[model samples]
Target: MKKLFLITITLLTTLTINAQKVYSTDQSYKADVKVYVVDQEYQADLLVFKVNADYKAKGNEGKWFFTDAEYKAVKKIYFTDAAYKADLKVFFVDSEYKSGWKDKSKQHFMY
Candidate 1:
């Protein structure tokens, strides 16, 4: 039981560390998060809450500070031309609880 508990904790920690911190990048490096532009808020896979400050940001919310340099970004994201090209299909929800991946298999992209 203890071994399983430890493994769970370690896995959670690793996932948190590797979670994407999205930054809109203009350059050539492959984006960690490939975003799609949905016409309706309901069409999005992740309902992104844009927080004013990075410190205030929690969970999926944060200040997406656009960086000229690709390396500076924690997670580089590009807007896909079509929804099919996107790794994850997102819908912007009004409430925090509403935000999540439409396809559960692609949940790993956000975290």
Candidate 2:
């Protein structure tokens, strides 16, 4: 009985953590998170992996839906032309596990 219970809990926890739905907001102030695209991979605070489908995007992997309105967005990001002008700088990674925040301070922005 204990083993079964543990398995159930583990499965539930895995599913919850792996699920990620992100929305890019039009306005920065109304956004849950702000992001900047860095010119070089070494300068990024987070390494992002954009999956083709929402289901394929898990954990740090994200499938972003850009919304016209602030209220409709789950997370808001303003892409700055320069890294110095942005808040959180990110680099696009190739895999999910490799996709994570290099700067621990910026970690909460994604979740």
Candidate 3:
């Protein structure tokens, strides 16, 4: 029983550390993201990442989508692209978000 308990704890710890901070790079998609508005700018509070909200990016979706030049913050970020001046979406990683898309479906990995 003692051995089993220790092993279980170890496994759980490992999973928690490596759990991917997942989110959609597209704002239109809205992948359980936390939207924020600040001083005529929008930011996504993504986890496992550091994002920048200095300018409005062109695209807002996909894996290889727009990542903040500063990758130390969150998932992605954007301000207002002149024509579209308004608060943008700020996608972040949270316990609530974790379960949001958990039931959706995993993308097939082909490598």
Candidate 4:
């Protein structure tokens, strides 16, 4: 009886963990990120999210923020950005806005 009770609790915990994963933004491949002012508020949205969030959000919490609409946008990036070009890697800049882009030739990260 105790074993069965424990199993039930375990299953419920797993389900809870999986359900909260719809909100995250991260990707391994190249894609465009948008920068715009919404009602004077700055924001950025990834071109790839729904699938990427689901697959990669497992460990990406706090690393990125996401919304359901951005997830849907990922599915149509190609058609929406036909003439838009994207950078090589994904960049999540700080809240402060900057115009110049980083060079791929230089090491932007250091461990």
Clashes of each: 6, 0, 14, 0
Q: What is the lDDT of candidate 2?
A: 0.65
TM-score per candidate, in order?
0.59, 0.61, 0.23, 0.22
lDDT of each candidate versus the true structure: 0.58, 0.65, 0.31, 0.32
Off by over 4 Å in 1: 1-20, 27-29, 60-72, 92-98
Model 3 per-residue lDDT at 96: 32
For model 2, what is the alpha-carbon lDDT of residue 30?
59
lDDT tens readout by residue for model 4, 20-49: 233223442322332222222122222212
Candidates sorted by TM-score, best first: 2, 1, 3, 4
The alpha-carbon lDDT assigned to residue 94 of candidate 2 equals 70
The sequence of per-residue lDDT tens digits that candidate 3 reaches over residues 1-111 is 999999999987654333332333445343333333333212322222222331221122211223333342234333333324423333334233231121112211100
lDDT of 2 by residue, 1-111 (tens): 999999999998776554555666556675555678766778888777776665565565444434455554445576656666667788877766677667888666666
- For model 3, where is the 10-residue window of minimal lDDT? 102-111
Question: Is candidate 1 or 4 superior in lDDT?
Answer: 1
- Pairs in clash, predicted candidate 1: 44-90, 44-91, 45-89, 45-90, 45-91, 46-90
lDDT tens readout by residue for model 1, 3-43: 99999999876654554445775542577777776777666
